[model samples]
Target: MLSTAAVSWKEPNVECSIDIGLCPNIKYKHKTAQRRLTLFEDFVAFGGVCVSWRLVMAALKKDFNMLPRVPWLMLAEKDDGSNLRDFYCPMKCKNIYRSMLPKASGKRFFSSQGWLLTIAADHEVNLLHPLSRVQILLPNLTTFSNLEEMATHCTDKLYHNFIQKAVLSSSPSTTSDYAIMVIHGAISKLAFYRRGDNAWTTIETWLSAYSDVIYHEGRFYAIDCWGRIVVCDVNGSCPTRGQIMPVMPNEFTHSLEKLYLVESLGKLLIVLRQGVTTRDDYTHGTTRLRVFELNWEEVQSLGNRALFLGFNSSFSVEASNEIKANCIYFTDDCFEAYYSASFADEGAPNYHPEGGGKDMGIFNLSDGSIEPHFRGRSFDPLSPPMWVTPSF
Candidate 1:
């Protein structure tokens, strides 16, 4: 009661407007002293809190110096409702954060290791690192070989589903001395673009459909649908015919088994997954899996390492305490999704008219149980959810 007479009349909002958080110089000094290896997304989330955090974000935007963080479960683009694409930062946040990515609008996405490859409606191809927003333009889809053979298909339809996968010899951020390889066309014909090339140079493996490609050691190794590997070098005026490795037999019979070629702990592996396409609803389900080395030795344990495979580039990670060890994390790589997005007039089979996302989960080898990775609406046909390893 006595405070009314003694207290001064001042506006709290106006008087307390100055930043109470750390000063810019102090913030930066602490950052330097701690030397914390911060995640790109984590810094973004921290920016919304106060003025000093925003300064940190500004510093990050100007100079991004961090390695790839834990794999983020980037969900599919939403329906016509919003531009916000949701992502689940697995080991970092364990929560969903929505981001507006207009650059990816209406474009097909393929992963080149940690980076993303986007194909525009005009057939313009671009390699984009989403976190860093650094982009490199490659020759368009029309530049690929055998375009004359696909005269019947519309340009939109052909370019949308043409690229099966893309792999980078080295990250474009670190150095310019690198090469890019893409498995494109209906038959998965392999092509490469190097540091000094104007157009793509095809490696005439003359094999069946290729599923995956990886750059290991000093050469590029590409595996086809029938489990045959062709090793080719990115040297010479034109690539000599690819040297064929002996075909590894797929004990599990599916049209195109052994989709992922992953090199973990200096050991190359063939992950065999058998899934049947139910044309009724396009609900593809996998029941059996075999992850084995190229020498036909079975992998019984992964120790502290985890493997991630999907529509994006397949890679392995050393697990932290927050993440599960010896678990295989997978995402939606349903080939039917592309046809559904591109082949509207071509009488493509409808995928679950119910309008829901595809199947993605983690399989524990020790327990043989499956668990959901994310519970987001990732049903966009043109651009589905994929595993994105964040890098700057």
Candidate 2:
């Protein structure tokens, strides 16, 4: 007959089994012994590999709970002449964070891995984490000898004439051995810099006028205005061009307003934005948003993911049931037609002078439909709305 203690062991949380009818049976002893032996075998199997199976389970639960509930989109606007206010996603809420940038003249050029890449008026690049108020300053713009030559080429606006975008290989919090790549020069040259490097090294490539650059799979890939992709190895003193991706479709290369490269789900994607020139300004009036996955010799569909495009950064995430797949969320910048060149002196190339027509919204890829995300808020031209993925 099984003992009362053994019966209690069979009930995980019960202090004791009250069923006297089954507890006194000798068969119950065999069942309880077999169950205990199975549990012991499991513990013995996993014990050699880890300190405790319980601890591993606890650590996994903690990590799963730490995942963000929802990603947020970030927008920057001028509160006064010098101060900038940051608005979080789902704009109806009162949650807004302010920038810690010392100079109001700074412009945001890139955002990734929970950092905002900004260029100050004095031509210093800084990485700022708005949520944590952490910042890192890279080597100054004049440190690059090639950039100095490019500056002399356009002496009137030396600082503003170069550096369209910059991207980092990894987050500074993760490792100290990170690299930075920038699309610089009037003709769109690629420049590379590592954490310990003294100056930026310009990569040699056949393509001219790059629209965007992204660091993916331990290397940097850039897309030119004509939708050509070039690969660069950043390990060398100067980046070496590795291979050019397959030529983009004629529809993507012709009349392209802007090109963006984003890494999602272990695949590289190119976002081609096409718009029409309206009067003196460019209006994205019926502009089509097309996303293509870059294969070895051809392009494919994006498949079940939504892309967010901005001047500083572009990213993709799996679409939930609520948010349909194959759609794009975008923000207005200098590439859009409503942007005026007269606002260039107002601080940063993206800054808007009139502070109207931020043109922020979502576009559906399945069907041609556009939905505006923000309705009543007015944003600064210099600090237009941008999509920011929240990270710690």
Candidate 3:
């Protein structure tokens, strides 16, 4: 269905295995001045150096509402294994469907390009397409050196639970030469695996721990707990780390805040979540929000783009009349201690006691105001909610 070529880059004394075979020469059928459409067109050409044309067309067609309906978030009831529901806030419509894979009891760690990265009970990793019911099993968790030792000591489950996030280099729907990168281990080590790799290659970094990662501009950029950014070359024999970006100034005192990295309008952004801890249960309630654009190692304000954050994934969509600019729609799952404890049930509904109020809400960047998005409905703290962009 597609053609391929072998592309190799050489750096003196270093081994590199970068694959650019899937990178297609994209052509536009029509020209338009619309900024969103132009941006999407450029993203297809330059975002990921190895993205296929089929993947680009599929993503753009679905995202731009060219299909019957634009994709919306799907919330899976944790306890119910038989059905899944789609929540469309813009259309105020809800559609229920049978579970695509009822036997997948793994906790979802990341979502990107219409794929969900999950870890099963036996510690196996998979990229699942919920609508198509397609699953790609990646290198098992036991393939990691440290995790293997933990498995030998009967503590693999405890260590495997540390993997909180993952991202795909390219959508598997169109390319078989994609890679999966994940942040795992007790101290948050970075590792990546390609399609044919027998094991994941870990990238060595000086940072103590990493918070989030995103693939942008032909490389992987990750943020540490202390707000430091590290870039990685994923295709190398042993993925090497590039220079660290400057850290942003701290404005909040709470140590429980969450950090996320998202690509918006061809630029990279770092979002910081500020919250207050309840004295009794220690659950977090968002108090303020801050967004900064990473411009050549400096941080600036994010202009005109609204961000969406959740445990499954973080991404940016254009601001319209319905979705205001300079705001964040966040879910309840912040990967807190209480929620992690419920992984045994694969983050089933009501695994932990409900907190003070629903954690899903919208935060305004200009005035620091918080408002509930789903009124009067409290979500399970452990299960939280995931923002799913449908693809079929």
Candidate 4:
């Protein structure tokens, strides 16, 4: 179990919450630096424990790996009867936070640029910001283009299952001129919706089986399963067709293929991640890396920078910013592909969704060393935990 438990970030009342005072021996613990990790949800409540602890917290601000920090792993919510969500800081502090989020009840979460897209049990959709706690109602996606005949199947959760992946052109909190795109349906397809739009407009394109989509250079780019890309300018109701690029060279194809599209510096990149041969485990571990430039050319390195790749918005950061440079921080994105508990047959393998989270790690690009990013409970199948960059 993690050091953290179910605790509210809110100011606790005098009845239930206990105040933590800094003892005279705290200096000795601070000097030795061997104390157990202390977990709290909010800095206000945490620092307000006592005057001495407040001063201690103020002095610890230079750690640079705490809450309100960017690139946090929004942990997968467990049914621990807390009715709260968890967020883990993986850089240095290694602190786990539990927050009361009633709006997220029975909802699956998808993230992009710190904004989360919540799919309710009844198929209602909403965009939420965790830090600001802002909610924006998006058009409910209860239907798909290819699966027109929904009478035979269960209506509620069937449509959401078809949604393979989603990404944003920009966060709504930052700009009004932003778009929401998703790859959905039985055969993966691209769809987009702008702010204040009542309906999601499906992009008319022949290129299908898209695994991932990313917004780069003012256009939406979707990558198919066969390493092909389609760049299209998503607009109003009358959507335009995307210009499909030629199939990329399949030089790094393997058994379980995964590709991510991201903007490293000022250039577009397609990162290919395949399994290692020596490993016999069912969980996918990344060994080799094949990075490509947008011009169909291969690149050598991401100098002085680190990449955060997962279900959320894939982004790159400068290593000078106290971040682990040239490492890929990935989460439990392979859960749906590997574990389908709801869709499994009677005699299918007993694969749990939480088991696939073991694949989450930091893969060093330089020497290819893989290390655990977060040590905690595994993730849920539908709304697995992922990398979320706070944009406040």
Point to the candidate with the largest lDDT: 1
Candidate 1, residues 1-392, lDDT tens digits: the string is 00011112231112112232334544442333322324444444444345565565555543434533577777777667665556677753375655556777777887765688898888888888765456788887777666764575576576667887888888887778888888887677899888776677778888998888888886788888788888888874447469899777565334554467887898788887666344445566655556878865778888898888877777888888556898888876766543453345456555554322466788887877778777655665666678887665
Q: Looking at model 1, report the run of 10 residues with the lowest lDDT sum.
A: 1-10
TM-score, cand. 2 vs. native: 0.72
lDDT values, one for every candidate: 0.68, 0.59, 0.59, 0.67
Candidate 1 has an lDDT of 0.68
1 or 2, which is superior by lDDT? 1
Task: TM-score for candidate 4, please give it.
Answer: 0.78
Regions more than 4 Å wrong, model 4 = 1-69, 147-156, 236-238, 250-256, 276-283, 320-322, 353-356
- Which residue pairs does candidate 3 place in steric collision? none
Ranked candidates, highest TM-score first: 1, 4, 2, 3
Better of 1 and 2 by TM-score: 1
- For residue 57, give model 2's deviation from the true position in Å: 23
| Model 3 segments more than 4 A misplaced | 1-71, 78-90, 94-99, 103-106, 148-160, 250-256, 276-281, 295-303, 340-351, 354-357, 376-383
> What does candidate 3 score on TM?
0.71
TM per prediction: 0.82, 0.72, 0.71, 0.78
